[model samples]
Target: MSQPPPPPPNQPPTPPQGGFGAPQDPPPQGGFGAPPPPPPGGFGAPTPPPGQPPAYGYPQAPQPPQTPPPGQPEGYGYPQAPQPPQTPPPGQPQGYGFPQAPGQPGPYPGQVPGQQPYGYGYPGAPVQQPAPPQGGGRKLSTQMQIIIAAAVAVVLIIAGGVWFAMGEDGGKGADAKGTTGTTGGGGKGGGGGGGTAADGPGKEKAPANTASKVAFQKPHPKVTYLTNVVGSWVTDKAYVKTGINSIVAYDLDKGTELWTIPLPGQVCAASRHTEGNRTAIAFEPAKATPPKNFQPCSEVGAIDLSTGKLLWSKSVTGGQGGDDKARFNEVTVGAGTVAAGGTDGGAAWDLATGKERWKPQVNAEQCYDMGYGGGAGLVAARKCGPYDQQYVIIQNLDPATGAPLSQFKMPTGVEYASVVSTKPLVVAADVGDSAGDGSGISDFFSIDEKTGKLKAKIAVDADRFAAECDVTEVESCIKVAVGNGRIYLPTEDHEGSGEYGQTNEIVSFELATGKPTSDKSDAGDRYSMFPLRMDGGNILAYKEPPYDKGGQIVSIDGATMKQTVLMENPGVESVRRAESSFSVGHSEMLFSGGRLFISEMMISEPSDSGVDDDQFYMIGYTTN
Candidate 1:
């Protein structure tokens, strides 16, 4: 992997040291050399007037021995050389009346070495010395006690100032490093939580009516059906499929098309998987001919999200004859591989170099549904046997090489409905429906993916399996999502009268116990919600009401079931009735790189003028 470039020269490489408002350095050390020699004529310079006892206050030279005055002390009367005053002890300061030798230690215990006492250096200054000890030691002067106390107070004030400054900068520093505690990589996609100044917490939510407040809108120039919308790792661009054969990259913020790539054939089905800067587009081609029973193409292709360029293409051949529709029905991208599976089997490719890594062996007699197993591996459901004795075999395969890691048969009487989730190992299937029609109650089974053993089973009402407005089969209405240790099932309310059209109620069940949880609330009663995907710890839901002219994209907390309206579309309304497959609104919505893209597909039959008409439009919004 390559390293990022160095910062610009004008920019500082690291944060400033010591933080702001720190104290300045203390004043330079004070002078401490011995005091200059006393000025001329001062105490030691010259003897005072002769009569003044030689300025030493000694009695005039003792009388030469005035013959002993009888009883006068014999020694005192004798001529004795004038004796000097008692000398002070070493390491003790001389008193005001005494003269001391140079280089002698001071009287104070903690005084600076070789420095004169403060009062001793100036003329006429009061010089108080420590009192001589009688039996006990002398005490420190009151003046000395005051000096020590003042020094301690100054030190404390400097320390407190430093501590307060660091506390203020700590929060800002973490945010600069993208450690805001909400999401990684700034909360792009339905992956995690993160935000900028405008989208972070405490900001007012976007208005419920946002059709006229759209930030950007772009329409397709050519007649094409919208397929999917993918975002760049940086959240700056959107890769949108205008049709199966063409994909256009648009500036997410500017609403301008950046680039477009055209594929080789009419696309039958497509899926997108993105990791970092790379996005894998796995699409199956449609066979031209009898429109009702179309055959699957022989190969699938991959494309680069940044450049809109084809990276590589691989063959997907295995099933029976030329008319056998063996095209990949499902395509998923994982950490290291891009996998595509259909009735024929499944194949995996290296994401970085587009090399074929592995292909799984399949029973030509069985039909399968494939999906990525939360980057852990590939998951599939294979159905085999006669209609009355049907059995669905579930397998977990190695992501690197298509080998089965675990396999188990669905409880005897049930047929695979769909792989609701692989992370929590939840599967939805139809129970006891031998006719192959999805009229029976749907059963949700939680399995131990590692051991391929059944953990729990819960039966859901049959009315919850009604079809979506655009699809005729009931199976299309049953959408399941798993996250935050729970399974979310969005089911249509079959009880409501036609006056209100169709509305969906999302029911959440605990993954560990298979029991309904209290997190479900009445907030979703007024609108129809479709499970999209999990965004961090929250579940992203698409809401459309029966007769309202606007719709809302809500994010429900997976743990608390607290609902937050993320975006609203005032101009987009649900189609009251399905006119045709192409006329259905709200085709698909995707959250990527902190942005959301919603698309609708519209198609018109050929007119008498021989001009075919088709229209596609995508709306974009910044989630952050």
Candidate 2:
């Protein structure tokens, strides 16, 4: 096939004037286009048939250019083009390749409405309005006008190039998804959430406790096989159990190990008490060589709080002589003394020197359990007689001399269970009826530490109490705290129909009258709220029920009864197990300096491929 000729440079090929492939009109009779058809008005003679419209065969009269809109410079508007007569071709489609006049709709369906027809100008196309008459009162020289138009075209081209470049690079070179920013550390450590202990007392009061959901920080510095944890109330360093008889100091801020200390024998009991910078750790050691029979743990020792250095070690052999094993059921250190007591008797040593301070004589009539009495001194609860006539004798003793400060006896039929608090005197004991069936109901009593006088007694609701763990094991049992002139109790109440969905609430009671200070129905309920401590007039609680998918740390305002979730635990669902007697064995949660420490023993089920055993995890979280 023969190739079509190329269109001329600087111009496109002109379509037929009226329609596609139409014939062109012949030149005017005067020849040479009749002197360019005389610009618009006649050349000097007002040439025309005296205002008569120009003949159909002649060019139309030129009209002065229309004024462009405001802000448009003069001489920029192009003259309107005159319409030509239309004539369809013999066999070709009408309007095919044809140019239409300005402001007229094109015959083609794709033409835009109200727009100039496509291909109005072609190579060698005639000018719509003849060039303005030379020297006919025009302001700009033809050459100067051309230069200005060229400059304007160049400026528009540069601006378009700059805009296109900015659109491509404006996002700082981010990918197609437009993601470009720094990721921050989650939780309070990055100022995102939770409570800060360094905020000190009275600062950073928690938000109103009405929040139902909370955000949790990702766990960091996770330590495995941590059997126990003891945190300092004033420092970030906490002592964590390393093995059966070993403890190590760990830095909470840096998440690093500090020092480790091996105990003399199997650690039977331990306590952490802080008084300013002087933190004391007291523990009882069982016999290194286990005999077939019961062996008394008569030896006790102490260690420095900041460092793992041993402060003191001593052996006390004075107790009721018999088959009764001599071991301190509990050990507490505070008020310049380290004390340990059990069924045999109680003893106190100087906190600074390890020298024996005093040892109360053991009597066959009374069995005692000793602990710090709210910074006043050491408290000893003495039990006497059988269950039928059981009575509790509470003694407030001086830490320096072991002299009794004050002593009081419980009304007949009351048996001591555990000391809940020393300051503002709160005790957990069982109250029985005169029937003596040993069906004594458990209750909490508030006493005056100074006079040993009873202040108020509150009965534990039977439906709310959880008797799963023995009261002696405070962590697994119901936790009680006294603060802001009120008593806080954790109770389990059914929320939905399921074994794991039971909710927990903190029931508050007025300490003076034993009347409930807040409505129990409105009290906030969680998975399982365990009282941690009283912080700045607020009660910090841990919420974790057996087989819970996860847990949370919550804060309840003492005065307002408001609750806020401080931290959340997404938990490891694959390892979650059902509640069992040994599920919370010896596990405890500690809160100090705006941080919460949790230690738990988890059991992995036996599989054909592996042995069954227990695993321990120590995890920490910030409160702010």
Candidate 3:
């Protein structure tokens, strides 16, 4: 394939950038991504039509010259003139690809007709947005972000090139998929999916050649403000990802839209744990509107992943004086139960039928279950202690009764803990805020599930490991895997052996010994890799794209720590553009059965810049 043609002579130059505290030099001249000085005949050269567009903790690659289709804006990051929001064209089929006409009810009570199903929120009005940081600027339309990003693409080189779409808040909330599961990407890291026996390792057999092609892409559900889509899953029958308030399932191999489950309100959080094809999520009880756009994440629902269906939706009140509907921050499915935990304490329901098993537990200890980690096993992080001081108590719970089988109180000053694995019982936390990078993790604690005894505390520098977990979230850790008796994590990017650029590697630490291993898998010069989730006994990692290259998925041997490429994405500029745009530390990423899925944790509404182009909600790539 050839490089896209540059923009025409009438290109609108970007205005001076604002907000950087210190003065800086103008963009470099005569290098990759610099606006080209006109062709030999100068301004007379004809610019080809617009074309081009993909990373996460690794830096982003230089963007291709984004030629805007005629009439669209040319620069990115600047606000555009206000214009009326346009609904998707008629044939969109509820913002889907390879259409399935799933019938859903019309707008809710008081909702205006024709508003998007994803609920970009009263489409007739503009939503509030946080001001751009540092200097406080405005956003370029979500879809139009890349066109002018190319003009400044050279900056990514210094960044080492990965641009995970974490949104304005550093915490797109963490991966939260960090738990245990028996199927579908196995809840972050464990033995499940890829059809492997519980005792053995399995790798998705790659074609003799590992190259891949774009299977399909789902556009970002049009919304005028930032919205949390918040989920991703892979199953035997489908590839699932969220679109605003809707849950969509697509055929794993063909990318056909199998079904779409519409929600009454926006999804605030989703369980990474899947029991076969069933999962759950926490959503707002009602839709948000102009003046009261804020909705507490107060309701929980059980979902069937295989056949898109909303099994049930309900909420409860907390122990302390609280609203009739208690708000939850997390939800999980494990051992035949769907559990949700948050400010309102904790609640659980039978997955098969929405029968309530337990409501929020109230006590004088000022205790409550803040969140859970489930799937292969069920565990809860209970919060206790007085207002002056707070600490987390980890519990190995009986899924059916929500009773603690064993408990271990986290060390003082540890406000949050991510359950990396429930069966083996590993938890990660940023003790005393020691990890200053805002990644939310600095150490891993291995515990004995049966006795709740501490096995070892493996300390890792925030700068050394790629692992991340939102300090306020329990199952948010990503870039972590537990199996083969060890915990694995990608190392932070470092200068590579090449004359230029950067790279990183995957390293493991023994759960029993809490000792680092020499065993490592290199990402090669200019490339950086992150642990997505585990498949069977092997560690599945995503290699972030290097300049002029595309991303790759490799299976790392659990015992030998060696890697075998299973899928190598096409280096086609347009595809690369789409491939590199998800969150590395915070986004949902899954690879199994020769297919790879990546999605943003949350999507945003375009700014005043009404220019729309090719933004995505989820993207899938498949092998030959």
Q: How well does candidate 1 score on lDDT at residue 470?
A: 12
Candidate 3, backbone clash total: 20
lDDT of 3 at 539: 80
Error of 1 at 622 (Å): 5.7
Off by over 4 Å in 1: 1-212, 215-235, 242-244, 282-295, 319-326, 360-376, 384-390, 434-441, 464-478, 494-504, 524-526, 546-548, 571-586, 592-595, 600-617, 621-624
Q: Which ten-residue region of model 2 has the weakest summed lDDT?
A: 183-192
lDDT of 1 by residue, 1-624 (tens): 001112211112232357322343542344112244433544323434545544321212334446557766557547655778777688765865466555453353213344332111122223233343477556645444344334444454454444322222322321231111111111112211233211123222444443323446544444322233322222345545545356667777766777777765544434434565555554445423443434454466666777777778776444432334345655666656777665555667887777887654455555444434334345666667656776777777676776667877887766444565666677666666532434334567788878898777765655443222111111122245677666776655433222223344455555676655433422232355656666665667666533323455666655434466666544332221110112223355665544556554332232344222222355555544
Off by over 4 Å in 3: 1-199, 321-323, 608-614
In model 2, pairs of residues that clash are 193-624, 194-623, 194-624, 195-623, 195-624, 196-624, 197-593, 209-563, 209-564
Candidate that would win on lDDT: 3
Question: What lDDT tens digits, residue by residue, belong to model 3 across residues 1-624?
Answer: 011212211111332256212344554586324355643433222332345211211113455655666787856844455666555566754442232234433434222243222111112222233233466567555334443344334454333212111111121111111111111111112221123323368657657878888888877677766678788889888898876568888887777889999888899989888886888989987777776576988889888887788988888775653657778888988788899888778899998898998988678788998888887889999889887788899999998898899999899889888888997899988899988999888789999999999998988876677788887888888788888677888777776544455667676666886766434566765667778777777788887766456788888666445567788889765776566555465467888788888777766665444322434667888885
Score each candidate by Cα lDDT.
0.48, 0.48, 0.69
lDDT of 2 at 73: 54
Looking at model 1, the pairs that clash are: 183-193, 188-594, 189-593
